[model samples]
Target: MQLTNHDAANPSYWQARWREGRTGWDLGGVHPLFSELMQEAHAAGLKPNARVIEPGCGRAHTGAALAKMNYIVTAFDVSKEAVDAAKVLYANETKLELVVADLFALPSNWSNSFDAVYDRAVLCALPQASRPSYVHACAKILKTGGLFLSIPFTKLHISASEGPPFAVDEANLESLFEADFEKVCHIEKQHSVKDSKIACEMLIVWRKK
Candidate 1:
């Protein structure tokens, strides 16, 4: 996926975007791939009782969707405005909690406590240096044998420096999750980048093993 808005490493940049209504990642509705996977996860017995976290949830559409489907969800974003919007959208959903906090600084009680971690754009959105922390955090928040659903943008033609949605590939994922998680499967689709270039889009699932 191409990131139209690339924010700085600082949180204030994103806060400004949210405050100014510059979010391009909020798809307004749940992404079809994520919606299908949520249903598939329910069929796999992770249903009304399962706990999930959506890190860096932009407008929290996916988390809200999951809450509607009976999954307990905690969606966090550094942007207070984003969280405020989400709260307004999900006022009646008791199954979801929206938090305004940095993903790296989540409370200790949350560690290793979730049945699943839904990493939408958070992984690739981070600067390269933060990826290890991100992977560790994802693994930490998920219980053993839990699942991690990652949808990261793969850099095919774009330079690594030209991104908030940084270029990533299987090697990046393996280097991050290989020790504590196993790649169960992955699907890649070519995405159109700027000026007719192509990017490798990946939907990967990892099971903590």
Candidate 2:
């Protein structure tokens, strides 16, 4: 909600980052924890062929990984450069679909359309003010009882740093999603961003109430 000319939550901010290859956040691969989540989802009766979404998908690496596992995946980014990169990487991937779109302005028909919605750093990238809208959109697009896999950058809150990768602590999460979601698990232990400046992160899985 800090209105500023350089707000990290702004789409133009990310677009510039993509254009300049300043994506320090890109792991050059999918989030390490996502593989485990996919396995868990499968064991929880989520069929590999079921639909999934990767909102704010940068380069769509997670979507590509899911597609390889036979999941029907749709990933989108507000940055055209990011989406273009994803298209080039998964040009022949039938299970993966990448689109240039805003998370807040998603297609209306997508309501309750996904079996799962995955987030790894996307919410962290937004300004604190936008997190509510982001949460609402994610909830709107997921089917009842669908998983909400969130692995957010927790540095600003935990380590006290400026962020795009903003500060989102456990308390902030509780206040944000408690109205429409039930935490399926406790706020997880701190984890690393893997070879990055971010000291740690928080993991939480939610189920729509």
Candidate 3:
């Protein structure tokens, strides 16, 4: 399972991982944290039928779950294989639309079109240098006062050069999005991943300013 490239920012790196069937990150279903987060969002006035988007939606299990919960979901991935597979897996979910699109270059028509963005590890999957751009893109697609829900790994021992999931802590998150988003909530929960180096995941909800 040795990959020649460790470049997380490149789509080809992820495409190759899928081609090799090396996606250990796929949870096979919606993440355990999603239901509770949805509840929190709902309590915060995020209603059903809201336009929700998931960036780097691998397999789109969460996206499908959102669709099942009656939200309009648009999930996109850089890898065509990932998007195609997700589309097939959730074929019956009419409210869920999966597309292959670069997160940094999303369609112009999508600007300020989303009510919320679900970023499950998408930020950690990217190189650290790309975090600013990643946050900018997410903020760009969201309407004013829209939500940004993120579940990022914390206390990861590995460096960016070692590979993702990269270490992203509360400070790291605030540094990137504080300019455009206001922190609404931050909850720390045990990670589903088995790695010891990953202490936990921080579920941060930010409202666009």
TM-score of each: 0.86, 0.89, 0.94
Better of 1 and 2 by lDDT: 2
* Residue pairs in collision within model 3: none
Q: Give every collision pair in model 1.
A: 112-140
Candidate order by lDDT, highest to lowest? 3, 2, 1
Minimal lDDT window, size 10, model 1: 189-198
Give the per-residue lDDT digits (tens) of candidate 3, residues 91-199.
Answer: 9999999999999799999999999999887888887888899999999999998999877887676665666778788888889989999988889987766665576
Q: What RMSD, rounded to one decimal, does every model reach?
A: 4.0, 2.9, 1.9
For candidate 3, the TM-score is 0.94
Q: Which candidate wins on TM-score?
A: 3
Per-residue lDDT, model 1, residue 24, is 72
For candidate 3, the per-residue lDDT at 33 reads 83
lDDT of 1 at 165: 61
Score each candidate by Cα lDDT. Answer: 0.77, 0.79, 0.87
